[model samples]
Target chain A: MADTVATPKAHGHVEHHDVDYLHDGSLLSWLTTVDHKKLGVMYLWSVLFMFFLGGVFALLVRLELFAPGKQFMDAETYNKVFTLHGAIMVFLFIIPSIPAALGNFVLPIMLGAKDVAFPRLNLASFWIYVVGALIAVTAMVTGGVDTGWTFYTPYSTTTDGSVALMTFAAFVLGFSSILTGVNFIATVHKLRAPGMGWFRMPLFIWGMYSTAIIQVLATPVLAITLLLLIMERTFGVGVFDPKLGGDPVLFQHFFWFYSHPAVYIMILPGMAIISEVVPTMSQKTFFGYKATAFSSVAIAIVSFVVWGHHMFTSGQSQLAGAIFSFLTFLVGIPSAIKVFNWITTMYKGSISLQAPMLYALMFLILFGIGGLTGLFLGAMSVDIHLHDTYFVVAHFHYVMMGSTAIAFLAGLHYWWPKMFGRMYNESAARVSAVLVFIGFNTTFLPQFLLGSRGMPRRYYNYLPEFQFLHQVSTVGSWILGLGFVIMAGYLFASLRKKMDAPANPWHGRSLEWQIPSPPITHNFHEVPVVTTEPYDYYRPFEPSVKGHH
Target chain B: MWLFLATEILMFGGLFVGYGLMQSVYPEAWIAGHHHLDRIMGAINTVFLLCSSFTMVMAVHYASTNNKGKTIMNLLLTLGFAGGFLVIKYFEYAHKFHDGLLPGRFFSYHGGGPAEQAMFFGFYFCMTGLHGIHVLIGMILISWITLRTMKGEFSSAYYTPVDLVGLYWHLVDLIWIYLFPLLYLVN
Candidate 1:
């Protein structure tokens, strides 16, 4: 039996002309392009800049620690380098890397929307972030802050550094973060397309939704915490100053109240991107879709109670420590479920080893190591031993570097065609991914061993015995840096070429694939009505395009 | 809109947590701290903020009905109250400065244990300083609303600006209510 399909007329004419590709010629137009694709690209370029900037600081820190004994700089200079590294990486890079960039670009398109709910506000949030980042960098140039990113009090208040200015910069950045969170929450709640039931929404949206909740609820606390620190530093407020009869531990309480769940904020969106890429490339519907979606929410909720785990050795009550440890362990279960679900999606399906798939595969292995090591830290006794050690540093890098950074690169590669309307060098992209994976492990894996062997973190100089691992980590950093440069060069060069990517470049099933490449302003001509579940691969693959180009 | 208010509450709620914890641990110091505050100024600021909130709501009501004249009138009233709050705060801070009740290592009161007294004055300056910034922001909003009302920009159909301003004014009043007790009524 022959199957017939509705084919377009053979007059060599397509039905629709590509709408105006450039944004409307107004400053406000570029400012308010809530076109998820534009927002995503903005986030991508901004965060990549911050990542390299932060990496530069990390390189300086590693160089100073290469053979110990202050070979590179004095304690004060070393203090600034490591502090800037942590502050820039945490506040500027990791926090906004995946979610704001990739998630902003894809979530609305996947949901089949014209734009986020508040387009103007989205632009305002981005500019606010830029302003906040400038203020932070300005603080570094003007005397530099040395209280570390945590800004633990007493010393923070007493130190003769630029604590007030730096804390206020961070406080302003918190407002930017809060605004983005608010925008995302409102968008997800009010902006899904018709017939796209909540359950049928992609796991990326669910992950973003959960992350938005945390961003809204938890970020304000950090804002207040930073505000208090600024007040304490500038006005000599007695809130966190021990000499003024204030409990320094109170600062710890306020800081970790936000910083603890901030870990989830850093990782949840990356997990969301993985959720999207895994099922599509594997050619299978995500197993336990609802379970995977719910796990994002579960992690967001559970992450709140587990923040006390960071304060376990900071003189918290034994009961509080136990409860936190238990909650931390409980949080692990949802993450494990996600891991299992991703692996199960690849079972007995057409698993394609695309560039994104390579990153996703590595994400599972790396995030697994990151997540399991977290359980070891969640145990009070083990954490007490590894607290503030290189082990802690290695574990977080595994999650932040291995998982979020990898997931970010995967999303970048996956959506490159869609965003720029051009295809990158896939072979070069795969090689960079491999280099990053190997270099990242070589850099951080030894830190875990050194941490287990009692090497402390954040020190300007270390004992000679730990020299071998530090050198290895430093070498690994250079490789990692080189890998990033290659990735950037290739993606940047791709933009100059006139490669036409088809709408469904990967033959993916999401709503974004239904639109034109380099989507028009106001996204879709007519809003798409989603009629099937995401990742529905059971039926025969129906190429939705009307005619082949 | 209410969510923004919730965020404001959490922001101040953090300061209150610090206040509560300090009071619990150092009841004597807190009571002594309250003795340093000018209750008269605190009470006047409270009335000023309450009146501002009332005028802000009135402006919203007028804006909803497209009564541009009354909208401008109420917004001016709100701005007047915000100005009044700032004037009173300036006097209070000036008086404290004259009394030499400064904060930190620079504190210079020759009274017995003036060091402890500086802690009290420190919280006072910080809390009121932050409140003053809020009052300044409120005044700016009120001025914007007045200008907008004069231009006939708002209507019953599109009054999110008016409603958001009302919410912000109410928060300013709410923060003063908490500040009144923490800064003045402890004794």
Candidate 2:
């Protein structure tokens, strides 16, 4: 078989090929771009900015907790910092980072489609995220939301801060999530290349598809929840307030109904990236590809039923608690299945210790710890003891920040060449990858210990007994922050001082490698005919148009 | 569009679950509150919505069959039904306001325990008000399609936008079908 792809002979190729998507940069062109790549890169930068912004708040929180006796800020300021940190990270950074940013760039191209089915909607979703984020910032500026990210009722309603404004911001952000989910679902359904069938699609698409399902299905609950919360705060609706004959616990139900599935929304895409990175680096067909792909859906489906597990300690019925606890365990099964399959895929396979691969490996270990810890918290009896503890906090940060956000970084490093048409310093990438791992584990591992020892989460001041662990955690945050800073420096340096990257720099058998680096305005010159399996390592999958250069 | 509807279903699902849970918790309060709602107006609104849905379906059919004039007319008729539903809603709300049946803390109806009464009205107003917002959104979308239809943008080959909008309007109708019995005739 010819290693080179059939050169697309520019058959009425009306588009100008002289300029890459990056060089044709004008503010208006960037803003009005319906091009998936440009929109994707923009999502990348915008979301990364949000990630660091959240990081800053996180550092402040850690600094405040460095010695436990309110280092500099007051208790109220501490509340605002952690709330904004959590809200900004979850809504603005983690949820949209991988799927909207990296997935937007890679998904269409990997499918060999010209663009997503709803390109306009993709752009609109990004802009909606921006507007929603800005509104949240406005809420923060107006007074700062003190209800924490969960915004539990009664307290949330009575709070003096900009609760209504913040909840409304979250409400608006739900539209962005829903729109993106809708777009991805439509694209995956309608826009696959001629030969790409369901199983032939990338696992990332599977992760994204399942994620989109959860996003569209679950996000609206959050929207309605926030709206009701706003109503409760602004107009004194009694649904969540006990004084009005409403149940405060019911608010927890509405919240976790969306939020628990929202956990899958945050992690699924990261798993998707790992599915890609693991296979590419290992040079193997993913071990149990069907199982791995199906697991994403399984995780999504199981995610909904497990919402009650979060409410176990909130005075929910014991029967409901036992049922939810069991469901939560079921959710872990699929996640465990994915982790097992990834490891199995790597078994006896040719391995490349690339920056992306390192991150994938980290995700494997970190997500494992996160998932296993979930089992501890899922056991109703055990959860009662660990409930609202730093252990729970550490568990989620490990899953969300460790697994999803790490996978985001991996995908970013993996796809950077194709996105920017340039190569980053691999050694610096490797160094920071390890730095992030050390930093992340250091920051959260102590929290788990502190949690087991009865250190509560979101506590402004701690007794001297827990001071050592808190101090260790605080110092770890600095390392994590430094790791991220190093990443920023290297990635920015790649934008200027680097050689142009080849399309298939990693030599993986995927459709994205079949396109030009920093792909043209249109991803493909013609719709590709994808005959081979998605991961056929025996033959190098050539670019659809080998003669583009 | 179907997926977006899935989200809408869940959004309404939250409110419905809240209503169900609260109703189960305070059955007497819910029953007493339900009696205060005008079943006649609720029925009228339901009729108006059902008729609008039929007209909306007809418009989609006409647009698909390339009957632009009939499509525009049906759309306008559907819009009329939508507007009529809103007008009736306005009356119902005005009547509630006059009776001091406001939601939450402003709820002044003291016959069936103010707190429980307020909770009932809260769900009623929140659910209906939210649905009303949906109705308004459906109207805006339908009117947009109407103008586009007038300018000849759709035909049998490309009536997807019309079909999608029809689906949304149908969801609105469907939600009211549930709301009518739940809020008005809570037997």
Candidate 3:
């Protein structure tokens, strides 16, 4: 690719660090690295490790739930399995997957900045997350938490397991989350390139900017909540312990206040990826660019109010419930607008079916269902019936797993070449995308029916009536696992191949793609003076292309 | 720095929300609980924290002006004020513990409605205890900045960390500003 030879500096593509980011390839470098790209890669690997670890726990959950009478593990082990699964997935994987991992890698380049405003703090955030994960592992080894990831009181307080360590782990992780948020916010505010005005930036920046706001503002609430919960369990503080006159329901309000906005925290970055992918794959500029950008901020603001909807069936006031239900509907508008905009961008454009495009399309369908189902739960009366059922489980899985996890995968596939300077098997990627979509639907879609048909979540055993759906869902989990295994195979296989990746493999209009496949240590030779809008596809993207993507 | 402070406010903001809800639920219990706290000591600690904030502001001011000597002096004053605040907190917690106002199941008070009183005391200890932890963290931060100031690492052209740390210290004081009223006083 000629772009690789369009040397911004005197050196051509021969500089090893220019095409790949392994640096000196020493343990010391990995340990003490402050480069945002290195930190982002570290975050990426750790989150993936956690994802598979959590996936194993999920498989065990599905295996146990395969038959109504408990196939293998006892009820106690079952409880611990599901709890560990939830805690691991939430804290270790999905929460940090997009924003901390992909955002850290791409946000700087997207804005044409050399690095985030606080590079040292970026390094510290990664270490803090590691420390927090270590604490959680210690808790697991000691006596794994079984109070559900929500850690609702009385059960959480009275549990003999390692609630204190686990909650403290979460509290520590909250600090990591906040530090990243603070760093991102500062970077967006102070580190944009000379000519990169706010609107001139890509949609991914807007999504990340909004996510950073929520991460900074909302994550701390979770920190304090967990701290109080930890204090409650360890010192027998009566805050969430009702036997000592504390309201457990009050704990619900506090938890969801953070956790709900946290839902957006999980999804918005995924939305950002979709926003980026649609423009590049469709070969068109973004539709409703301003609305799409502002919608992220709008979603962030509205997310806080809808948290009360999570507490609707938990003995909140009637007036409060009605208001929450109303506000919950309001939060959907921004998401609906984003979906509409993505489709509109694809409307008359020369859309191509690429690997990343396939995942983006899948995300559109899956996330649409996820958001629409949220409306069902948002309705007060419907939520009352489905509150603790598998329905709620399925609903959130649609949002969390179906959307966020899938989006993370999408972003991973989309940027894998740029990050590694290697291209995976395109056909294999497309097949994996299909398997993932089908397998995911097969796994979660049945659970929704089981939920509606009166299957309670967190059940160690169930009646024979719910067995068929459970079996179907269990089969779906295997297919889903197979999809991931195939994905891992091709991704790893791509690493060993000799074929080098083109810098602009996807013809992406973003700054990250315009540079070398794997960008240099400092992203640009000079901080790029941005003179064009992102996804300026109206301009001839490649007037002299060697070959089309 | 402002973004970080916003997080801190939201963090303590959550705790205050919890405190507010619990207080409203058990008004008489909260009323009964606040009495056990040493109001005069609380007032004094508040003054100490306020003075610390002022000193921190002065440290930033001096650092911005590139006056390393005055910056160090004001930082020392801020640390001294934080120390004074901790000393009063020590005595206050000591009095409560001495009077058997410990947390949860450890509460040995002979008062009626032990559960309700424990609930209030629970919030009291949690709120003040969390605040106390922040003060300790703030002191450590201040000491670090003090050493940095003495080492002449900061100047007018670049005092971002000093200015940021000052923002953090003010947030601590601001949280205490609310914590004092909510935990130490009631009509």
Among these predicted structures, which one has the highest lDDT?
Answer: 2
Winning candidate number (DockQ): 2
iRMSD in angstroms, per model: 2.0, 0.8, 1.2
Candidate 3 residue A381 C-alpha distance from true site, Å: 1.7
Model 3: CA > 4 A from native: A1-19, A541-549, B111-115
Q: Report how far residue A542 has shifted in candidate 3, in Å.
A: 9.5
Name the top TM-score candidate. 2
Q: Estimate the lDDT of model 2.
A: 0.87
Residues A438-504 of candidate 3 have per-residue lDDT tens digits of 9999999998898888888999989899999989999999999999999999999998975377677
Instruction: Give the Cα RMSD of candidate 2.
Output: 3.4
lDDT of each: 0.80, 0.87, 0.86
Give model 2's TM-score for chain A to 2 decimal places: 0.96
TM-score for chain A, candidates 1 onward in order = 0.94, 0.96, 0.95
Model 2 docking tier (incorrect/acceptable/medium/high): high
Give the B-chain TM-score of model 1.
0.93
lDDT of 3 by residue, B138-172 (tens): 88988998898888889999888898889888888
Q: What DockQ does each listed candidate score? A: 0.50, 0.86, 0.79
Q: Which parts of model 2 have CA positions greater than 4 angstroms off?
A: A1-16, A540-549, B110-114
TM-score for candidate 3: 0.95
Residues A1-549, candidate 1: write the lDDT tens digits: 001111112322222554534443465565566565676677778888998888899888888888878686899998988899889888888888877777777778777777777777777777778888898888999999898888987888888877778887778777777777777778777888887889989999998888887887788888878877776776666778877777888899888888888888989989998998998888898999999999999999988888888888888789989988988898999999999999999998887787888999999999999999998899889999999999999999999889988888788888877777777777788878888888899899999999999998888778889989999999998888888888888888888876455565666888777666666666666667667788888776543322323
**What is the C-alpha lDDT profile of model 2 across A1-549, one tens digit per residue?**
012112223331224544667777787789988988888889988898998899999999999998858679999999999999999999899988988899899998888888999899988988988899889999999999877899988899998989898888888888999998898889999998888899999899999999999999999889888888888886787888988778899999999999988988999999999999998888888888899889999888888888998887898898989898887777777888888899998987888888889999999999999989998898878888999999999999999999999999889989998888777777788889888999999999999999999988889988899989988898999999998899999899989864457666677767777666777777777677778778777576544444453
